[model samples]
Target: MRVRRLKWAEEFLGSAEVVVQSPQDIKGNWNTYMNRECIHLEIGSGKGDYWIKMSDMYPDIGWIGMERNESVAAYAVKKSEEAKENRKFIQNEAMHLLDYFDKEIDAIHLNFSDPWPKKRTTKRRLSHGNFTSIYKQILKDDGELHMKTDNSALFEYSVVNILKEGFSIEELCVDFRRETHDEDAISEYEQKFMNKGNPIYRAVFKKVKEEN
Candidate 1:
């Protein structure tokens, strides 16, 4: 999906308070910037609605939105600034997450990530074994990962990959609204899917210690 480039997006993102020019500067010191203990990361944060809302909902926790597209990321950064939330937007791809962050995240939110359904592109999925390995490195030993999607195939694939990577599934819901409505955070894409009567699948996986 090619995002339409906004004329002032570059300028806006550069000056946006929530936009991080170089995440490497913060590295493992993210808590210092937010002055908070719990930090959560949202991968493929499209327009930042979910994380921005989450920041408002959970003031005690710091939020980080990661996106590769500058145009959409600009909107997220601007929104975070306007909300005065403890949230930051990083304009970078999820694959290089380790390059910017160390073992600093308490939880990860994967909301409406790309399915990458093709067999050849399976490795590109956010929940793939390769990406899960990277996530483990940057996440705490007991860190949790929450994923929501409308694609059942992608959800199933993610379940298999997540378990294969040694994470235990704590919660699984084929219809998130029915199973976990109270805890659900509706994102832009999630709202669209819900309006169309699509059932959302959600899962929470926690990292468990491996026995020697």
Candidate 2:
């Protein structure tokens, strides 16, 4: 269902507008949110649950949650307004990633991105090298891509893709739930799957050097 135009939300976001329309606009005057040169991104943020918590936890850094769906995006916007000073939610797709971020992003988060199980639809996966390449273009030299998922097949494919794409896989775990995950902020789907004892897979890929 579509959400009504929230006047409060519009005012809240307009007051703390950090979103950019193109990569070209990312540079210059970035100290609007935090004095430090750092930014974090969460792709496919479903309900802004994790985003709200993270923004509350980390005040010195900026958080941007991107969700293409309008209703879902509104949900994030509502949460962001509650902590309007540090977090922002964008209603858009991940394909336009470069448009919103600059080269100073400290980290990128891909929490349970679409599996895209079929071989033919592999390119659509966020973990695909093509997306990774785009991510590298806007990420800082030593930035990290933190990813988590419960899909085993997709996890395996991501590992292969990251390696083939020439990125260094610093940390990887087949079952994130087996061990106590401290930074685990439960997402809308994560809570539902936790009851089933689903094993969540995770990996942190760091861009070591430019790919030729």
Candidate 3:
């Protein structure tokens, strides 16, 4: 179920032509809809800098940006009004990801996600065991989960929790910005954080289905 680019991208993605009104209907068909072999989903795509830039940098790969905050989602949409090809926006929470995508996602990107530092709000973190359970279901067997954040505590928590969920840690870097990763884009917010001597932690967790 591909969304037709009707008018120029509007901020309210629900009514915008660039967003899928009913993403649930597009489950398992996102790659087909976007006409790309691989699809990457960016959860909590605040302000859309990473989503917009990544889509531009990788036109051959389908990109789906998900942001629950409609206001923030709008900002990202407006900024990338013309970069609609191989891209679609979703204005919904990540919990409903199962309703919108099956085990079809090639990769998932979690960038500068909320730390949810409070001990009681641990489950609210995007990389919590609960969320990783969902990620396992939506991701392909060989899919990878790429996460980056400026919060050290959150990074440690995520690393522990993700491993507890049984995902394999394929790559882990304490200071992601220290290296020149041309394949990965650094958002303005991230660059500014690095300028402040803040180190960005990044990890790549991979999944491999067990052979029967």
Reference-based lDDT, each prediction: 0.86, 0.74, 0.86
Runs in model 3 with CA error above 4 Å? 1-11, 210-212
Error in Å for residue 88 of model 2: 1.4
Instruction: Return the TM-score for each candidate structure.
Output: 0.93, 0.83, 0.92
Model 3, 74-107: lDDT tens digits are 7778787774778888988999998999999999
| Residue-wise C-alpha lDDT for candidate 1, range 1-212, written one tens digit per residue | 35789889988878777788889988989888878898999999988889888888888898988988888887777766674457778888888888888988999999999998889998888898888998888888799999999999999999998999989999998987865565557877888999999999989999877577
The lDDT, on a scale of 0 to 1, for candidate 3 is: 0.86
Show where candidate 2 strays beyond 4 Å. Answer: 1-24, 27-34
Candidate 3: pairs in clash: none
Worst 10 residues of 2 by lDDT: 15-24
Best of the two (1, 3) by TM-score: 1
Could you give candidate 2's per-residue lDDT for residues 1-212 as a string of tens digits?
Answer: 24565546545444445433343454533445445557888888877777777777877778778777655666677656554556766667788877656676778888888788998999989888778887887778888888888888988888888778757889998877887766667776776777788888889989776656
